[model samples]
Target: MSEKILELKNISKSFSNLIANDGVDFDLKKGEVHALLGENGAGKTTLMNILYGIYKPDAGEIFLEGKKIDISSPRDAIENGIGMIQQHFSLVPSFSVVQNVALGLKELGIIPDLSKVRKRIVELSNRYKINVDPGAKIWQLSAGEQQRVEIIKLLYVKSKIMILDEPTAILTPQEAKGLFETIREMTANGASVIFISHKLKEVLEISDRVTVLRHGKVIGTVETKGSNENDLARMMVGRDVVLKIDKKPSHPSKPILKIENLHVIGDKGIEAVKGVSLEVKGGEILGIAGVEGNGQRELGEAIYGLRNYTGNIFINGSKVRSGDVLERIKNHVAYIPQDRKADALCGGLPVYKNLFIKAFSSPVFSFNPYLFYPEKLRKPAEKLVKEFSISTSSVDQEVKFLSGGNMQKVVLAREIESEPKLIIAVHPTRGLDVGAEEFVYNVLLAQKERGTAILLIAGDLYEIFNLSDRVGVLYEGQIIGYSEPDESHIEEIGLMMAGVKNEDKI
Candidate 1:
């Protein structure tokens, strides 16, 4: 029999009262793609971290090719031929792809000649059918191109076993398809892969076998062909998981939010959001759909009062040209930012404290300077945590300790619970598993039922179709076309996303 390339035996890890990884066993076969499936905070990342030497396993044994091994750090894991590409990519945005790849490797004291590295990168990219411009700055590349850079970085290091965490979270459907093909090509070249994701269809499509984790425990492992999304979701959540986003038929009323001739420059000094006009009605979710980096982020930030924008923005019959961010919020507006780590929550603070960030000065949670009562704040914080199904030990727990999805839940809980007239949710369910996505959808539907106007800016076409009452296709920072959700097709939106106008283009 072929040797198992990697083996993790009875791994367990913890952080305070949270047992991130219970006794779990995992193995990877050479030249095979093994998928790790679970809900958010189901110990998938924790387990991968233990393998990649980011965290020490309290009780476990790691074996490489039937021989026990000790991996003490990220360097150690890399030296042992294991490479990890994280969800939030670690790249110097201003540096070229080759420079970013060669940054840490320069410590080897080798001759600092980038030509050799560039040649090797080209060879690797061709071998794996992955294309990345080594001379392109990280910021100059699209999210898909940046992902290819990450994969190329691993390949440049001669990594035989590659681990990708939530690889498709930010990719469009077409980009995701390309990535799956690349994974197959890697495995074909004798590289074993550990694919970590909560996306069920992609997992079944790419993996040879699947392992489900739940609350730090390994629930089951099954052949990909023998299993289905429903079976895997049940194992991950330990229940009959509902995958559908339920909603009542959209009854859009008068326009509550309107934008006219809006234009904004991206961070790179390019015109990101072009002249665009759109309207969102009361009790409606207007989903902005497109390939990411096509001006979606800039549009959301500008409308949410985070960016300096040249345009007309009207909220509830009032012009919001001169209003500060807080002023906008006070005028019945709430924003859940796209990059949760940098913009949404304060990671160092407790969950309750983070919840009070925007509301701390508001009379609802505080009275005056040096005279604050947490009891009143705690009541609502606790209630929001429960309502959002946040899995934290307590509201007093540091926000950083919560999983990505849970931290997102805290952001949503704070933003949505206050009952704002207009809510801007940007990729609100970005990294969540099936169950959590359903919960968020239900929350949005509930808000719509309350006649709240919602602007959902997301890259996932399926999500936009499923949850939005109407979708506006954003291309080159402008709303190119608008379509009723039920009447539109994914291909139409996709074409518009690439700046192909249906009327102008044959």
Candidate 2:
């Protein structure tokens, strides 16, 4: 057995009334990747935060190299060769990669010469096959490139113990492959890794062992080679989960959503979407496939009246004007945005209030035309909570306090209850567990069977192929190709995603 590089004994942490971690014991050996697998709010992040010194455990002991050690702050952890890359990258948007890495280096002195920093970054990047340009500004990098920068930052700091939180959530399949290769190289170089991910396949692929957490305690730790996806999922959710969606064939009807010559500008003042035309019929899903930032956001926002666009959007054969969100809502067009907290829900409000967002003024929930009959909403909210299997102490609990999966469920329940004619779902299952994903898929398909048109803009090709009846490849702000979803079209779609147009105007 390899030497135990890190160990935690009887770790307990709590926030307010919530028990974040309960007498948790975990260990990691030298040159091995240890994964923490759990549903959101299952205490995986809490344990990692304790190890990273972001939070002090209420009761615990941490040992490094067979000697007890104190990690009181991030500074202490860094000095002790521990580092973490959070889901959100910590680099300054205005700073260069080299400058961000040189922020805390003691060797560089007060003025801090960056030439030495750049050289070391290059050396580490090449050694680990984790590619990044030292001179590039943080805002200019893609999500994958930005993640590589985070890894290089840890390498530059000489961190022997690395903690990565949901590392591949924003990456493409190719980028994830590169990251797995980098993890292998890191282990080969004798570094120990603590990987936290919702994806079970990734846990099995990158880690030597996985420790499952539920509620706030360790369920069990098992060797990766002996376990499968179902085993890990059961350990995480305490049940046998359906890992695949059983999709049914679509029966098309009249167009529920139609876009004509759409040209929408992005936040950067560029024409992100250009001359895009498409239609999604009742009982059909038109999936738009592309690498992130290929105008997917702009197109979705324009149709939902959240962005300025010189285009014509029609729902149920009626024209939807620009900046008329309420009008579109009246027309029964529902939008499931990419960022739930940012665009979809009011975080500070309770789950019940968020659920009543669209129906707040309806006669059933309103009295005297301007005020809500609070009692009228209680039963329906409780019913929605139960039907969605939302894990919450109460419907009166703040929506922000819910887990990611539960939060998404709240959003789904509210939108589906509105009974829209058309639905625009954007990255609906981005950071959910296998169990949560299965539920979302079933809900969307159920809506489809009811003849609701859907526009699915997603980064995962597998997701797109599974739910979509027709697929459109979006490249450089254009629909380069449109085809029926099938395994044989993957190669052509792959080419189109890279901005290559077929000669037949595909």
Candidate 3:
């Protein structure tokens, strides 16, 4: 057997009355890519936190290369040669990549020489085959580019073992492939990597071994090559997982959502969505397929009244010409934003409070003017959290303490429980692992079966094909093609997303 780089034995953690991690054991071998798999609240984040010295384990023994080490803080973790790249990066948006990477390290009262850091960063990028521009401002870079900066930060710290938390969540397919290749290079150079992902395909492709977690316990660990997705799904969920979204033949009902001659400007005030007209019925999932930044974000924002646009929008046959975002929501339209942490969640608040944000004006939480039951309100909120399988110590736990998948579950649970006439999900399963993805698919299918209209804007072609009843391909501000979900081919969708049109149309 290969040498063990890190090991956790009998590791457990709790908050007040909630057990986040219950007696878990994990091991990583040198130069190995070990994957940690779980549903939301399955204790993955807690375990990583313990390893990274963000949280002290209540009871456990940690051995780094056969020597017990006391990791009291993040500084200690870094000194011990362990680094973690968080799912939501900690980069300063206005700062250049080099500035962001050297931010905290410079304040250690050392020589603040940025040129040296930039040189090291370039060398690290070259060594790992991870390309990044050190001079680029964080905000101007693509999501994939930002991820490269995060990886470089870890590498610059001289980390022997690196943990990547859902590294491919925001990447394009090509970008994801590039990231996997980088991971391979890192491991090939004799570094240990612990990857956290919900995408089963990516995990299977990149991991040497996979560990499955469910309800704060280890279900099992298996060699990636020996087991398939079905086996992992069964272990993670404790049963046979449904792998397909059941949908009936889509027929046009009365149009619940209509956009006529819509045009919207991008974040940089350039034309993004141009003259796009589409109709979504009350009982169908209309999928918008595209590469990222192909106007999908602007289009969803425009429909939800989050952006200024030149167009007409009608919901339930009523004109929403001048409606605001709140009005659109009140009119039985729920939206799940692409970036959950930025758009869907308030990290400072407790889980119940975040849930309250969903139905704040509803009668259940508010009786009338000036009278509200704080404790009584938690009943419904708790029920929703439990039903959705959101992992938290309690409904009162801070949302920041939850993992990415749990945070997403909170957003989905709130929106879906709202029972909206239309649900707009943008990249709904972006950071979720296989078990959580399965749950998300089931939730959407359940809503569709109940005749709720769904507008799914996703970059994942497979997800769009699997869940959508009808699919539309978006290019540079245009709907380039439309077809029934089953009849459409992924290559055709890819072409349209690349702004390629048929020669006949030209």
Candidate 4:
């Protein structure tokens, strides 16, 4: 057996009434890639945060190489050869890669040598097959390139223990494969990694050992060689989670939402969505599958009436005016945006307020536009809280206090309850766990049964295949291919997503 590089004994943490971790024990062997698997709210992030010094363990001791050490802050962890790369990149968008890396270097004086820093960055990039340009600004780089910059920062600090939190969540399949190669290179050079991910297939493929967590407790640790996806899923979720969605075939009706020759300019003044024409019929799901940043966001926003575009949008056979969000909403259009924080909910507001934000002007909860009947609002709010299973002490609690899963539930409950004819759901289950994901799928399916036309814009291929009646491949702002979600068409769809044009398929 290899030497144990790190260990946690009797680790426990709590936030008020909620226990995030409970008497957990975890160990990492030298030069080993250890995967920490869990569902959302399973304390995976909390445990890793404790190790990274972002949070202190309420009751625990950490050991490094058989010696107990106290890590009070990230600086202390870094000095002790530990570093964490978070899911959201922390690089300055306006700064170059070299500048971002050099920002916190104590040895780099006020007048630091830029050339030397660039040389070191290039060397590390080439060493790990991380093809990042040191001179390029962070905003100009792709998501995968930004991730490479994060890895380079840890290596530059001489960190022996690396913690990656959901590193592949935003990456394409090809980019994820490259990240696996980079992890192999790191472990080959005698660095241990604590890879925190919900992706089971990647965990089984990349990890030497796997540790499962359920409801803030360590279920068990097992060798990856003997563990399978079904085993891991059961342990993480404490049930036989149906990995595939169960849904009846969608029945087609008249077109509920129609877009013809849609052209929208991105924030950078470039045409992101170019002459795209598609129709989503009532009682059916039209899934748009593509790599992130392939104009999916633009397409969603254009349909929601949030972006200026030259297009003919018809809702229930009536033309929708350009950039009129209220009119679109009145036409029974509900949008579940990708970023829940920025686009959907008001974080500071109470849960009940967010629940009825779309329907505040309605007579059911309002006596007048200036005054709201509290008792009337409470009845509906309480019903939604119970219906969606939003775990909160009171409906008056701030939305930000809830966990990620509950926050998503609030959004789903709100949009689905609106009884919309057209629901534009973008990355609906992007950061949710298997259980919450299942809940979301059930809700969407229920809406489908109610004859709601859904345009599911997502990057997850599994979601596209499982839920979509007809799948369309969006590449470089155009619908490159369209096909039914049959198993035989998987290979052709994958090719179209990579911008490959198959004449026979398209």
| Runs of candidate 3 exceeding 4 Å displacement | 106-111, 362-369, 503-506
Candidate 3 lDDT tens digits, 1-506:
38998998989998788787899999999999999998777888889988988899999899999999999887899899999987778899999999999987835356678898889888989888888999999998888999999889888877899998878888999899989888989888888999988777788899999998777788888999988878877887777876665656765577889889999998776899989999899888999988898899989888988888898988999988543887887788999998788888999988887887856667764567467666875898899888887877788889987878888888988888887999889999877766678778888877877778899999888888788988998888889888656634766666677787744344
Query: What is the TM-score of each predicted model, taking all chains together?
Result: 0.96, 0.92, 0.93, 0.94
Please write out the lDDT profile of model 2 over residues 1-506, one tens digit for every residue.
38999999999998777787999999999999999988767888778888889899999999999999999998899999999998767889899999999987788888998998999999999999988899999988888999999899898888999999888888877899999999999889889999988888788889999999898899999999989999999999899998767789999899999999999998778899999999999999888999888999888899999997897888999888987788888888888888788899999999898998887555564556555666777789999998877777787889987766678888888988789899998888887877778778888999999999999999888788879999999988999988777678888788888887777445
Per-residue lDDT of model 4, residues 152-237, tens digit only: 99999889999998898778888999999999999988899999777788899999999998778999999999889888989888
Q: Between prediction 2 and prediction 4, which has the larger TM-score?
A: 4
Candidate 1 regions exceeding 4 Å error are 106-111, 364-367
Query: Poorest 10 consecutive residues of model 4 by lDDT?
Result: 361-370
Report clash pairs, candidate 1: none
Q: Is candidate 3 or candidate 4 better by lDDT?
A: 4
Off-target runs (Cα >4 Å) in candidate 4 are 361-397, 504-506
Stretches off by above 4 angstroms in model 2 are 359-379, 502-506
Q: What tens digits encode model 1's per-residue C-alpha lDDT throughout 42-99?
A: 8888898899999999999999999999998989999999999987789999899988
Q: Cα deviation of 357 in candidate 2 (Å)?
A: 3.4
Go through the candidates in order and give the C-alpha RMSD of each one to the true structure. Answer: 1.9, 2.6, 2.5, 2.2
Question: CA lDDT, every prediction?
Answer: 0.86, 0.88, 0.85, 0.88
